[model samples]
Target: MGKREHCRTSVLFFPTFVNRFGCGKAQCTGVPSFRIGHAGFLDRLVWPDLNRRLSVAKETIVNRSNRAGQIAELRKVVMWLYDKGRYHDALPGAVQLVDWSRDSHGSSYPELADSINILAMTYHALGQYDAAEPLHVEALELRRRCNGERSCAVAMSMNNLAALHFDCGKFGKSEELYLRSLEIDRNAQTLHNLGVLYHAMGRFAEAKPLFHEALEIRHEAPGENSSSFALTLNCLAALYFRMSDYAQAESLWRRALKIRGRVSGRRHPDYARTLNNLGAVYYILGELARAERFFMRALRIRRQVFGDIHGECAQTLDNLGSVSRAKGRFKKAL
Candidate 1:
């Protein structure tokens, strides 16, 4: 019953939100135009009115589509606000939709399930683990009742709940749930997550085969440069590094870095982690020059992305300092 803490910064910028006018200006301009910002003015006037209408619609609405549309629009707005790091503003609207979906249409089980999932995720994001847990449990129960436990939808619910367990440090419970979910994935991504769980638990022997299996599946079913694939490669690289297989580790780290860069930008934390891992491989290989370069690059990127006091940046700095000291650059190390 643990909710994920809401520490994630908003991925969306309020200034870049697309207006209802459907101009798609945000997508086209790469920056929101004045017209989009002006739309906030409309919210001031319409939001109160919409809330009144939405409340009435939920109770006595004869029109299904209109009620659905109103709730959907509110959900979208809540999601947008959440993405913008405006959790306080987003929560009430999200809760409103949860109530609406639960009560408005008696036959809309699927919609209700989806809304519950969203509510659960939102609560998780806010660190309300106690609140999030029951919501996820409810959704899982509904999915299982509607579509057998082996169904992909149920697998997703189990995986999500397992992740929540992992985040909450319930490793034994997480392992049990993950194993159940793994039986249902029949796909590389799920296996990859299982591999990561194994790696986290220091079960390198178990993790390695799973990573290789995921890689093979991805090789056969290639498409977009998926973060999941990159993560699999990175986990394998880390496991290899732990085993002192520097050559294989370095190769996988570079490949993971390339995929992460292509998909999530070079400045992303995933790339920083890859860079750090690659540097560790070089450090062990006694290739001090290459190690220093990668470590420094990683340090800089982590600092820029997460700031100097962040744990990731601190780790990178410590690594760079250790490497410098080993190379007899004591002054530089300091």
Candidate 2:
């Protein structure tokens, strides 16, 4: 008889026959019969058949567990590299994470989206917008798929894409995405970004309220001394400087500088930015010596953080040259 027929016959008649004959170690011709409805019967009849299936299930569980641990470790390393500004070093790991998440089940869509977003952000930091844009688009679509259209995740993706477009000088597209993100979620970062976009467009009146709103939200959530709050303070100060409100600009810049100093110290790039902005304010106020000092400090910090060839260092050099010329030292300016 065929194997299928033999298996079907055994299943259909074995239990009744064993029970009726009370076959507990009973000998039937040359074969030992198994007792029905007992552990012995299951072990005797099914162990060989089920052992291979059980082993496969066990191996699958172990592999999944190992993959999950690997993903967790990758996330930690990727985030650490990003925080340290090691974008190039982080890129391979971020790409690996994306590939792994994509190969995972549909339940891992959120992980896939996160990996895509991080990879896009790393590309953006490297100024490779061509590579970054499609990744951001894919991340947004994945987030929308995993977490509905109006979710905070979707809103964050929208905000990131908007920032990318803004950097690319696609103002209209950026503004549209920013507005859509704000409509979905009243996030402090989104508010600040939209305000910055408005400020860039010279819409001072529109930008002011948004900046204030963002500041208030950040202050309430992360508190006034938070880096995010200091960032908004610096942005608003920049707007004030552009508007020629020197005193107000000086005050805000000073506060931001103090906060940054307390949080990140003098060697930080953020502290250098505040120093540069403060120097600009002093330059406008005609305090040439004070302006020169701030500019020098900013230049020193920028050189330390980004070396000599950075745009920030060049800008600080120009500011110093302006200070020298303003003090009637034309030779020094040159």
Candidate 3:
């Protein structure tokens, strides 16, 4: 219905033995990306942290010849930052996009709803649930009002809001919105997120099929990116890990790790996530040395990229502590 991007950064990474991926179009592009952007969008994809992507976005803005073009470029920048897990940087751009959309198209415009959805998800990614919820609610209401309840736009909004609810531990609300979304479209993002919710709630039996369904949809998607496919693998591995099926979890995580390493690289948070997950699995299997090695690697990456103030940091630290405790390194654990 509109040309808004689908910033898939709303996928809450599970604070468990695994990570989760995103929902919606390939991110702010109106295609289901599940938190992936065009990984090859830039030349050779240089990165310590996708610096090349940022540089190109800046260069593109300089080249755009009109207000519309600039706005379009800015939206891409916001979505890229969000997809790459750069929420702190994405926030200002997301807010600016919302304001620009509203100024150009008014409060009730479909474009504005999309911008609002992106901003709400920025907050969602930051773990600012209180700030995120109302914006998510507003986006859903605006989209439903502007486009009605049965469209893809509405379904996308439902997925966004449901993800927020999942993070907030509002299982009933999350499930309600996800089911409503699936009723409109059995898209990959919603299926993956709904499955994640079921996994978090300990409904392993229900979550498994949904994860499989989501994976199949992703497999069938044309030109599917490794990030999304890896995430589905990651979260499904998480489910198996929760079920004490370490062998299954390890196999899935290994697949995800390979894909993420190839696409997102070792320094990327997605790669760090699989490292942390593997650590947890090894810990459970009494491979203390292996668990400690993986935990250390993941912790280093999180600390370098996200600093000390994010859930990624917290989760990795907790894992490290467990490793130290297991190894009788009490001071290190502390």
Candidate 4:
């Protein structure tokens, strides 16, 4: 539902991610006492052992010693990748989960529906909206069948479909479904998404309170320092940015940057959004050097996730071009 993302690097180069346990001689922007630089976040810490984790899960599935528990372990592995912004890596496991669930359970089983949502959301994260939509529709139907139309599961299904519509610029459809979901359940996610839709529609005055209320709800449930809270903060910051309240926007986005980094990490699209937003703020303040650094970091992350021509990368490139123009670097601007 969000372009969720990582790192602090100087303007001239990419950030060096070292071991979190690197020698405490040098300090950089990092998590607590562990500096962010060369933190080996994914390579040494997360990804290095990922194959082993996947292999163990696969072996358990093959052995079928405890089929339900084995599949749950596989789901956890796949979700771990998905949650960490490793959508490309998670695709195979997600597909396998759906396939196995359908074959072993049934077409109408709740497990299959849940697997489909995971796969669909992963596709959504990758900007494969078309691939995600039908799966969302199928999952919604399955949810209605399995848990009844008015159940929380169906509401979640509606919210997922709504977010996809919102991403696709189907504001009216998105609003309809979001409102429907809200009627069924007033969860923080649906409320935040609705606020985002209103923000996009230029109904800033209407959007403001929804964000605030959602933030309050999230504060109560997930507490103040969760990814859900960060998302709401990011959108609220974006709203302030649109309203030309630069200081407030920057302040709010700064909070989101720290929170997302701590919870979601830097290898995510959402983190890139925060970076790009901060860069825009700096650009507006005529801080070209600062703006360039943030833009370059965001651009690199977007390229890694979506490649060069994708909309997110293109947006960052355009921002960089504008920064060059502002600095009278006409060749770079062109």
Indicate which candidate wins on lDDT. Answer: 3
TM-score of each: 0.61, 0.72, 0.84, 0.83
Colliding pairs, model 1: 1-129, 2-129, 3-128, 3-129, 4-124, 5-127, 6-125
Global CA lDDT computed for model 4: 0.67
Order of the predicted models by TM-score, top scorer first: 3, 4, 2, 1
Q: In candidate 2, residue 183 scores what lDDT? A: 80
- Candidate 4: clashing residue pairs, number: 18
Candidate 1 vs candidate 3: which has greater TM-score?
3
Model 3 residue 320 distance off true place after TM-score fit, in angstroms:
1.1
List residue ranges in candidate 1 displaced over 4 A.
Answer: 1-67, 70-108, 115-135, 222-224, 286-334
TM-score of 4: 0.83
Best by TM-score: 3
Alpha-carbon runs more than 4 Å astray in model 2: 1-65, 84-92, 103-108, 307-310, 324-334
lDDT of 3 at 142: 87
- lDDT score at residue 266, model 4, on the 0-100 scale: 91
